[model samples]
Structure formats: structure tokens, C-alpha cells
Target: MDIYVLVGIVIFLALAFDFINGFHDTANAIATSVSTRALSPRVAIIVASIMNFVGAMLFTGVAKTIGGKVADPAKLEHGVEIVIASLLSAILWNLVTWWFGIPSSSSHALIGSLAGAVVSAEGFGGINYSGFTDIIKGLIFSPLIAFTIGFIVMWLFKQIFAKSSPHQINKGFRTGQIITAAFQSFTHGTNDAQKAMGIITFALVAANLQSTLDVPWWVKVAAASSMALGTSIGGWKIIKTMGTKIFKIEPINGFAADITSASVILTATLTKLPVSTTHVITSAILGVGSAKRFSAVKWGLAGRIVISWIITIPVTAIIAALIYRVIALFM
Candidate 1:
């Protein structure tokens, strides 16, 4: 097959992955608002879709990082094939976890798959240890930071509103969630949509169609549009898990979680690092729940979620590696 043809296929697959990511991670943006009844599902989806599109178009630093960090696309003989395998493996893992209503990280899936596919094609020596470790550090620590920030934010909320009537406070935060949710969705767009753009640009670079890590405008538009469309479709299953599984979310709690996670995510975007919005938002919710009352959280469910987080990277990496070997048979 022509490398150009393969590049075309990669483009399609990258958009498809973005679309899947849109719905798959959509829950991260709107779950709290929907759970708290701050916004109806229909309205929430609309808001998220628009904000995600806008956010996706506004940045490309993370895209550049993703394009060049895992392994230099220019250095590989079968770079396009590796991209195909990586996308296939990432998409497969995403769908599997989505089917089970697990809020797994699309970021991890893509990063792991890219690493696995690269190693499969060029051996461990091909991997960019410094860049890979920097990305991994962002992914691992962002959630912990989000959790701590969420706890402090909730604690502050409690302290400031302690004298207020509980009913009135809840009512006010319920309305405030509208703003936070929109902001959350925007930040989600900025970070999550860029991953697909990065992969597509990586493919372009690998195929010798481009010279730099710069993301083309067309790439950004395609990625952002795909993500917005997927967000419009909504992911009700994950919504249920994020909204009410780990803890029963109230308006105040939702507000705290949304703000904390959004801040962490947006910070990562600005720093050109890819972090898991799912992990950050989920951990933020757990922290808020804990601040509300440690005993009130369902620790079993939180444990299950953490387990999923722990396993996603290794599992997806192995899957991508095997898939790459199978792809090599035909190539």
C-alpha cells in the first residue's frame, strides 16, 4: 500500500478516535452538572459540544508534544503503520472500557499505544525516554493534585458557607454549576481533542508530508468537529458512573469538583502536557466527597475505579504491541 494511502487512513482513524473520545470522555465535563440537576442532559450536551469545539481550536502545544515526544516520527521506517496500530489499540481499549461504563483515560490509551507500537516496530531503543517520562509524570501526578485541590476547595466552601442555611447554599451552587460545567467542558476540549490532532500531525510528519510539529488548521478543525459531534451524542453510561457512583453529588460538591478538575486540566494544556481528564475529574469528585464526609463515599467503587486507572496503560500497551506485530505481517 502507498504511504499516502496509509496516511489518509490514519487521518480517518484519528478523527474516529477523536469522535470516540468525545463521547467517551464527555461524561467528565457534564456529569457533575447533570447529577446536580444544574443543567438538563440535553442542554448540558449542547453547552459541552460548543465549548469543547472552541477549546480544541485554541491550543496546539500539547498536540506538538504528542506528535514528537513518544518517538521521533522521522526516525521510524514504519511510522505510519505504527500509528495505525496505536490508534486501533487505543480505540479498542476505549470502546471496551466505555461498554463497561468505566471512565478510563483516553490519554493513557493513546500514549501507551503509541509507545507500544513504536517499540514493536523499532525496539525499546527507539523510545524517547526523557519525553516519555515527562508525559507519564504529568498523567500520574495530575490526579493527585486534583484530589488535593478538590479537598481544599470543598473545605473552603464549607468554612465560608458554614453559617448559611444548607438549603440556600445548595440552591445557589446549583445555579453556579452552570458556569463551572461550561468551563469544565471547555478545558476538557482544550486537552482531550488535542490528542487526536497530535496523532494526526504525527502521522503527517511520519509520512514525510510535514516538517514540523505544528498542527495544521485543517487538522484542528477536523479534530474539534469530530469531538463536538461525539459530545453531542453523549455518553450516558459513564455519566452515571461519574455522577453518582463514587459519591452522591450535591450542587456544592459538583461545583467544587468541576472547578478543581478544570483548573488542573487547563494548567496541563498550557504546560504542553497530556493528563487524563477522567482521572482528574474522578479523583476530584472523590476528594470532594471525602471532604463532605469521609464515610459518605463508597470506597469500594472508588477502589474499582483506581484499579481501572492502574491497569489501563499496561493493558493498552500490550494490546498495541501485539496488534503492531499482527499489522507487520501484512506490511
Candidate 2:
């Protein structure tokens, strides 16, 4: 393949992953709204997609952090092979999770695949300890933070309106759900689209195609456009799992969960940490459910989700390793 054509193909694959990221995780931002009838499923997805696009345009720091600060691109001497392996691994995992109707993290899958391919390509020396450490910390802390916030918010709402009528409370929270869901969608764009942008920018650098660490405008446009398009398509299968399987979502609980997830995600973005919105929201929902009653949380389903989370990185990494080896033959 021509060098230019190879680059284009890599870029397109990255964008495809971004689109899948948006669609696959649409449940994180809008599932509760759709379930509570606060927004029809179609309308909710449209609104979420718009906010996701806007969020992507507003946050560029994440792309910089991943592309430049993470594993160095120069180490990826086999740039095309690296890109192909990473994206194929992530896409495969995304499809697997989606088919199972489990909400796993696309962000984590991408990172895991990238790490695996980089390690395979150049051995341990190619890895960036600093970047790896930050992501590890995020993987642990983001969900905990979201869970705490979710618990506190739900508890506070209950305490404050101890005597309020159920109907009145539900009405107020239904309105609140719109705002919080939008926040989640915005934060989703800010954090997630950057993963795709980072991959594309890193590819450019590795291929000696770009001059600086700065990602080109075209990269951002492509990443954001693909993610938004994916969000518009929505993920109804996972939506059922998130909106109803873990817990029966009421307006109040949904509002609290969305608020908690959104706040944690946006804060992580500002710090340039790429945490999974799926993990955060899922944890938040669990926290809210636990607050109602320990049994209300459906530990079985939660366990399944956690198992998926644990497997996502390693499973995708293994797949990425295989992909790298396969592509090496072509290269």
C-alpha cells in the first residue's frame, strides 16, 4: 500500500472505533432518560449525540495527553501494523460486549489494545510507565468517586424531601434527569473522542507524517464526527441492561446516577485522564441502587458487569497481540 493510503486506512479505522465507542456507550448517558420516559428513545439519542459532538469539540487536552504523553509514537516503527492491531482488537471487544448486552469500557479496551500492541512491537522498553500509571489510577479511582457521589446525592435527596409526596418528587427529578443526562453525554465526548484522536495523531507521528505533537484540525473533526454519528445510531441492547437490568430506574435515582457519573467524568477530562464513562455510570447506578436497599442493586448482574470489566483489558490485549503478529506478516 502507498504510505498515504495506509495512513488514510488507519485514520478511518480509528474513526470507526470512535463511532462504535459513541454508539456502544450511548446507554451511559441516555438510558435512564429513555427508561423513565423523560425522553423518547429516539429523541434522547439525538440530544445525547449533539451534546457528545459539542463535548468533543470543546475538549482537546485528552488527545494531547494520550498521543504525546502516553507511549511514544516513535517507538511504533511499524505504525500501520500497530494501528491495525489496536483498532481491530478494540472493535472485536466492542462487538463482543455489545452482543452480550454488557456495558464494558471502550476507552479501556482501546488502551489495553494499544498497550498490548506496543509491548509486542518493541517489548517492555516501548511502554511509558508514567502514562500507564495514570491510567491505572484512573481505572480504580474514577468508579469509586462516581459511586460515592451517587450514594451521597441520592441520600441527600431522600433526606431533604423526607416528607415530600412521591409524585411531586418524581416530577421534579424527571426534569433534573434531562440536565444530568446531557452532562453525561457532554463529558462522554470530552473524554472518549480523544482516544480516537490520540490514535490518529500518534499514527501520524509514527509515520513521520506530522511535524509536531499537536494534533491537526482534521484529526479532531474526523474523531468527533464519527463518535457523534455513532451516538445518533444508539445502542438499544445495552440500553436495556443499563436502564432496567441492574435496577429499576426511577426519575430520582436516574437523576442522581447521571449527575454523579457526569461530574466524575468531566473532572477526569479536565485533568486529562481518560476514564471510562461506562464504568463510572454503571458504578453510579449501583451506588444509587444500593442506597435504596442492598438487594435492590442486583449483585448478580453487577458481578457479570465487573467480570466483563476485568476481562476487557486483558482479553483485548491478547487479541491485539495476535493482530500485531498477523499484520507483521503483511508488513
Candidate 3:
């Protein structure tokens, strides 16, 4: 196949992955607000869709990191094919997880798929160990941080509102959740959507159409638009899992979780690190639940979610590796 055609296929696959990610992970952003009745499902989705677009357009640092970190596209002879395999694998994993209402990390799927595809094509040395480890560290530690911050924030809120009546406190926080939800969605776009941009930019470099990781304007617009459209579709299955299954979230719990997760995501974006919004948001909710009342949280459900997170990378890596092998047979 011509390099141009392969690049086109990669572009298509990257966009499709972005679109899937929007619904798969963006559900975490609006789940709390929708569950608490802070915003209706229709209104929340619309808000998240618009904010995700705006946030996606505002940054490129994380894109550059993703493009260059896992492996150097410039060094691989079949980089475009590797990227195609990665995107396809990631998309497959995202869809499977979404169907089962698992709040898995799209970041882990994409990053793991990229690494696996690269290794499949060029062996383990193809990986940039320092860069890959750094990215992994970010992914691992960010959730722990989000969990801690969520606990502290919730604890503070509890103390401050200790004298307030439950009904009055929830009423006030329900309104506050709207702003937090929008912020959460916006931060989600800034980080999550950039993975697709990074993958596309990686293909561009691999195809010799670009000399650098700097994202083109058209790439940004296309990625942002695809994610926004996907967000509009809404992931109701995930919404149910995130909003109500993990714990019974009151308006106050929702507010704290949204604020904590959004803060962690925004910080990661600014630092040019790709963190999983799914992990952070879910961890935040769990932390808040623990702070509110440890027994109230369904630990078994939370454990299952954690197990999903733990396995995402290894499973996606194997999937992408197999995909690359299959693609290589054709080439």
C-alpha cells in the first residue's frame, strides 16, 4: 500500500478512536451532574459536547508528548501500519469495555496499544524506555493523587457543612454541581482528545509528511469535532455505572468528586502528561464515598473497576501486538 493511503487510513482510525473515547470516557464527566439532577441528561450532554470541543482546541503540549513519547515514529519502517494496528486495537478495547459498562481508561488502551504495536514491528528496543516509563508513572500516580485529594476535599466539606441540614446542603451543592460538571468535561477534552491528535501526528511523522510533532490545525479541528459529536451521543450504560453503581452519590458527593477529578485532569494536561480521566473521576468518587462513609461504598464494585483498570494496558498491548502481526502478514 502507498504511504499516503496508509496515512489516510490512520487518520480515519484515529478519528474513530477519538469518537469512541468521547462517549466511553466523557460519561465520567457528566455522570455525577446528571445523576444528582443538577443538569438534565440532554442539557448535560450538550454542555459536555460544547466544552469538550473548546477544551480540545486549547492545548497541544499533551499531543506532542503522546506523539513522541512511546516510540519514535521516525525510526519505524512501518510506523503507519503500527499506528493503524494501535488505533484498531484501542477502538476494539474501548467498544468492548463500553458495551459492558466498564469505566476503563482510554489513555491506557491507546498508550498500551501503541507500545505493543511498536514492539511487534521492531522489538522491545523500539520503545523509548524513559519516555514510556514516565508516561506510565503519570497514569499510575495521578489516580492515587485524585483519590487522596477527593478524600480531603470531601472531609473539609463535611466539616464546613456539619451544622447545615442535609436537604439545604444538597440543594446548594446540586446547583454548584453544574459548574463543576462543565469544568470536568472541559478538562476531560483537554487531555483525553489529545491522544487521538498525538496518534495522528505520530502517523504524520511516520509518513514523512511532517518533520515535527507540532499538530496541524486541520488535525486539531477534526479530532475535536469527532469527540464533540461522540459526546453528544451520550454513554448511558457508562453513566449508570459511574453515577449510581459505584455509590449512591448525593449532590454534595457529586460536587466534590467533580471538582477533585477536574483539578487532577487539568493539572495533568498543563504538565503535558496524559492521565486517564476515567480512572481519576472514578477514583475521586470512590474517595468521596469513603470519606462520607466507608461502609456506604460498594467495595466489591469498586474493586472490580480497579481490576479493569489494572488489566487495561496489558490486555490492550496483547491485542495491538496481535493486530500488528496480522497487518504485517498482509504487507
Q: Number of clashes in every candidate structure?
A: 0, 0, 0
Residue pairs with clashing backbones, model 2: none
Clashing pairs in 3: none
Assess each prediction's global lDDT (C-alpha) against the native: 0.95, 0.88, 0.96
Residue runs of model 3 more than 4 Å from their true location after superposition = none
lDDT of 1 by residue, 105-151 (tens): 99999999999999999999989999999999999999999999999
Instruction: State which candidate, 2 or 3, has the greater TM-score.
Output: 3
| Model 2 Cα lDDT, one tens digit per residue, 167-231 | 99999999988888788899999999998998888888888988566868888888899999999
Question: What would the TM-scores of all predictions be?
Answer: 0.99, 0.98, 0.99
lDDT of 3 by residue, 234-299 (tens): 999999999999889999999999999999999999999999999999999999999999999999
Where model 2 places Cα greater than 4 Å from the true spot, the runs are: none
